[model samples]
Target: MHDLLRDSPSSSPRGSPYGPGDWAELEEVARAGNFDVLRSVTYNRVWITGQSYCRNRASIDSCERHLQSLWYVYYQCARHVSHESFEQDRWVLDIIRTRGRGPLTRPAPGGGIDIARTPEGTVWNDLPFLATDMTEYWINSCAEMDSKQRINAASFLAKLASTRIANDRLCQIALDLFRDTFESERPLGSSNEADDENEDRHRTIHGLTIASLLPSACAWIREAGHNIILLSDASWNDCSHSTIGTGGFTFVQSELGQRAPGGFSPWRWLYWLKRLHQIAEEASKADEKLLAEQAANAIDIMLSDVKERNSQILRVFEGAGDAVTQDKDFMGLKRKW
Candidate 1:
């Protein structure tokens, strides 16, 4: 329904990511009682992109926070949609309590906010990316679920699904973060990228486009009557990975990696900001010209950023020690419990 409402293609071609057969395959897996695939497909790509370190030692921790919320979303799905013997009724209440109590925004009165107090219409960072896969997998898997799972499925869908405004706001936040990063203007710890990678295994996950990483940004821009180049089919995803125990892989694909036809380069985004400030200087009451120019500049900057980042990745790989890009056959990974 979400895809249908947006008039986007509901499924990819047979060989494309999330291919036409994926839905049935997902449903079959669910029916056969292998729920791990549900979480793996939903979380793995995000875990790679949002958590893995790369060229500049940067990671999208905000994306990680978004996925954690989704972890709770999955727990909700499991309790309500899956047939696991454990009683899930209590677990559902716990999810509701955690999500509803607070901290979607401000701290609580007693020093920590409960999830229940989380604001309605508040756009959490990286939320759209988190929901994109979760919604699809949960809905498909729950089709074969029992009555409880079905009821939970409805609730899960309601919580994970969002509007264009929500999507746009989330994207705007990511762009803002990137801008702050590119300018080196962000105060230290401004992003979660500061976390020193510990003993926990680290793997670089790539092959996600800007469109895939932050769809809400695309949705948000489109609604503003501006073209978002990142959404063009040509966009690609690039990042890296390394660890002591795990062999690495590259995520590049001829199909997934494409020139963003109309998107802005990160450099262009900065240039536009400068241009806007300049226009702000000349604006006789903020004329339409300023708005129009800003919009055009923004589109250019994002697309260019993706291209330049990919180029940078290539350079980093060429100069660095033995390492891997995200180009390996990750579909073969078997998760160990």
Candidate 2:
């Protein structure tokens, strides 16, 4: 199989360089349930093709054909194959990590290669077969990634989060990543306007992308009976008190005051809160009792926090004397609150 794939011409008129006869033989191997051999050959072929493409030695079409072959074998024997086998494959992890490195040196002169445009990125974005493992890998890797790579990773995970295939583990990973990234103190703004603006843009992009994961994560929590205690148990110790506390209802509330320090703007905070409110309302209408109650409690806590913040602002105005109350801006602020 390796020889056949390696020796195949890139300009073949067929969709794949491998002819029908070659596929038939491969299908026969699959029918015989020789998955170990098939998997080994498939990974080897994929790695070679991916490397060739990354190095600009192979066409995108050729790389895509290799992925097609992988999907073919996976679909052919999906029932017999264990997801763990695919997840544990070193080749799979290598392919995922490759995204972090961006495309290898291209012969043509351009700026940095867009990893999202690469075939491996296509595998990360569109292939549902390995979505679970990919999502987990990216979530864990996001911490060490540069801002751009983190944004890309968050974008991929957000798409996965919207899908029905997102499981509890993915939700847990997303939550942990969110808390770890946002709860930490961010760097103080620099005097360089360009640098500060760029930093703010990255923060907004990252926050919004990560926020997209919340709906699905909340749904999973609701399905789990809103079991905050179970979620924060030793087995799931990575889930911080700020995250699983209140069954994830306090997630946005806890970060509401973190605008300047945590890099989330007030608008972004409101967006997160709005999403939680929508989820809570949906749960109530669906008669998800535990989730609705937990969500209501979270809403109450959020309101209390907002009121306290407003009170603090009012005190500041009062301390500024009667002129501050008479100021149009102060009136606007009061009405806005």
Q: What is the TM-score of each candidate against the true structure?
A: 0.23, 0.30
Tell me how far the alpha carbon of residue 293 in candidate 1 is from the true structure, in angstroms, after superposition.
60
Model 1 residue runs over 4 Å out of place are 1-16, 51-124, 129-149, 157-337
How many residue pairs clash in all the candidates, one count each? 44, 0
RMSD in Å for candidate 2, one decimal?
A: 18.2
Error of 2 at 306 (Å): 29
Candidate 1 per-residue lDDT over residues 196-271, each given as its tens digit: 2121123111211121112222223333212222322222121111111111111011221121111233223323
Model 2: per-residue Cα lDDT at residue 238? 29
lDDT of 2 by residue, 209-307 (tens): 222333223332332322222232222332223333112323335433322222222322333344446555665666655545545554454434444
Measured by lDDT, the strongest candidate is: 2
